[model samples]
Target: MLVKMYYNIKIIIFKLACFKLALPADGATGEHEDTSQPRQVTSTRRTQVSVRGPDSPKIRGEVHAPIRGLKCLCTNAHSMGNKQEELALLLADTNPDIVGLTETWWESTHDWAVNIKGYRLFRWDRKGRKGRGVAPYVKKQYTSLPNSVGSEDGQTEMLWVRIQGGQGQRDLMVGVYYQLPNQGEELDWEFSGQLVETVKSRDVVIMGDLNYPDNCWEEQSARSDRSHRFLAEIQDLYLTQEVHSPTRANALLDLVLATGNDLVRGLQVLDHLGDSDHCLLEFTIQLRVSKACSKAAALDFRRADFNELRRLVGEALRSQRVRELRI
Candidate 1:
């Protein structure tokens, strides 16, 4: 009876060992390949992207002519999305001295990547707001200051930098601003007096996505208190609205307002760039002596080949027979 019981125990233990051997090893996922099934992609991240417009700005290796003193370009990105890359490329192609962008919709989590080659970026983030922000990039080559001398503080979502150059070294108070929809009237009323005071006799250029419809521009708005108030401030400040063309969908959302029209020149609306609803507002400083009209000679650096010139001079002198080679 004892022998029979021991034999039964051994048989049960053998069966348990066989079952354990058949099972998968520790930490095994039990994964299997199925040719008919689509392979799953691991570690994929969702890329936030924007719908690029038909007239999205393209990158060209060509560099445009530089404006003396300052050449500024303003545009509303609507939503920068992945187009900051394209925007930087476009800026390199156009080569503006300063760039103002509105509606960037930039968030804290976003990786700041819209750095042009030689510009210093000043940003005023729109905290707790969606699809609204303001920033400006000023070229390092220019003489710019953190703030203009004798300048006062501005309202929220506004940034200013003083550029001192042009005819007679005239100082320009450059700024980038964004007033939220239904918030314009308040801004005009609240900051109107302060802004006028802050600019304080300096030539002013305050630009960005004002968001006011073009119909309201100049004097088309009869009932819009905000429009009237905004326009009133502009007139009171002696700022000329340089952008007459529609920025987005037949509406002039982006604006370029200058205090002294004589301080700026060649106001032009450029083609739509990279996924932006608005167009580019391009202009240069209007110096007392315009480069084109003045007889003042400009150094022709682009056509100059210093080495070739040196070689030519050396050859001419080497072959010439001098009448008297005196000191």
Candidate 2:
């Protein structure tokens, strides 16, 4: 049995040697030779990337400018009543200096809930109406006051605020406007008049839902007469629309219009606030604002010496007792 096993192993080794001798050498041209070059093995690991969506805000050319100026946010809330918490979250996340909201659907009754902590609210609600309203919230540090520069006797849903700028800078005129869809020509003219008056200022920023879907901001043209008029008005006033992304659906309804070319730096269209279909608009204004100073004084306990304080108190008590004994 051992001899038979050795014979079988020797036969297997002989076959293996015959097969190795029959194989072709490297670079030998034969029917089994491989003539193609070796393929490069690329890395299978993926690189992290961020892709901006179709509804993402168009980054303006002034992105490289100084980012130390005022940070502002605007959104057509559709109705701000139920979205205050969401807005508050957005406020905390963005830490904007100014916030403008259109179609707030606010009434005098909403005064109780409209005030946001660290921000002063200024609003213009449609008289006797429930749907249309505009509100602007300025940080508590900024000295902001309601103005009538861009309002037409409550005819249009608009609110204006004069924000005090830093030293050596003029006050910024900020307006929040909400143009009603399919409104009368008179209302359009009134809103246009408001823009005309507001644009007269050197520093002006107007933002809201204009509702002119036919106007293409990229081409700077409009098919409808109303959009054409608005486009023409913007051109005439030398106002630049910094928001290029679609705020509502496929249309660019929300806008951040600045009077001068340099007044706007960057604008971003963020996610919808709460359940509102319209997206949020975040932008930066090219003006420096004075920092808010705190009036309350705080005691510093970190550097305090409890032993020294007790010694001083005992000395004062002893001195008082000595004086009392003398008296």
Candidate 3:
């Protein structure tokens, strides 16, 4: 079993780096959970109007109806270059309820730069660095709004949001991070610990360009000490990784880690936009019903009315014996 998992990881990682991971029939790195009873496949109702964007017409998948939790899209926009219009159109077409953008490379002062119609944006920008920022976009239709928790970690860019989507879902928490490459140092375990501590007692989704890879998870050590600590810190939080496909330049730097199996209804790796090196992680958030699914009760047929049947059988046998003697 261990060998099979490692083998799968190796094969998927290789394909991810090549940017070839797509479609389940094409062997994408997706292991969808199906045990939940309340989960339903998303229906794509045909529309007459034309939607603008490169990926809009191409976007097709099982998107759940937003009666519960909303659909979510995560990506690293990487400085918001020529792909801004393309990315916005893709979101507008797909109609995800929430979207997370990391490495935005835009400062908070440039609020007018981002334009996605009908959605309220929550963002945290980096002033000093040339390439650092994080934020989530919540759709207007959602009743429970999301609030920014601020970047509690100083060393790396970290962003957290409290998504209040009424009760029964327990309110979802999302943490975004951009751990820049070649920092010449290890991850601050203290700060990582604080990120985990903040999302306690809630259904959380931690998604970003984590920038740590583990071709080495099988060895109990990683390609770098950096990855080793990353795996450890997340494990301490009991968050399972939902997005395993490679996000950028064939490495699985981008990820979506959540608290339970049913939180993410679906996930896909999309083609990169314009000159961006990273692809998109398109995923959906299963509503409250899917999250709270309980197995139906069963009955044991063998335990039913056996004693009464035995008595009736004995009476029948005695009557048969008496009739045989008379004959």
Best-matching candidate per TM-score: 2
Task: Kindly provide the TM-score of model 1 when superposed on the true structure, using C-alpha atoms.
Answer: 0.61
Taken over the whole model, the C-alpha lDDT of each candidate is: 0.62, 0.71, 0.61
Candidate 2 residue 109 Cα shift, in angstroms, is 2.5
Tens-digit lDDT track of model 1 for 1-327: 445544654554443333222333322223332233222222122332111111111111112123355778888777777778888887878898888888778877664575667988777666776667878889865545444222244445677776534323334567788777667444555556547655554557888887778345655453576667677777777778877778778888788877776766788988776867678888885533223333333443444555655565455445423213321
Model 3: per-residue Cα lDDT over 190-280, one tens digit each = 4465565655555677788877666443344577677776777777777677876677766888888788778876799988756778888
Model 2 agreement with the true structure over 203-311: per-residue lDDT tens digits: 7899999888888888998899888988998898898888888999898889889877778887788888888899988888986433333444444455455565556
Model 2 TM-score relative to the real fold: 0.66
Give the lDDT of residue 306 in candidate 1.
Answer: 55
Alpha-carbon deviation at 275 in model 3, angstroms: 1.6
| Candidate 3, residue 327: how far the Cα is off, in Å | 54
**Candidate 1 Cα misplacement greater than 4 A, ranges:** 1-67, 148-155, 214-222, 287-327
Stretches of candidate 3 above 4 Å error? 1-67, 143-155, 184-187, 215-221, 287-327
Ranked candidates (lDDT, high to low): 2, 1, 3
Runs with alpha carbons beyond 4 Å of true place in candidate 2: 1-67, 150-152, 288-327
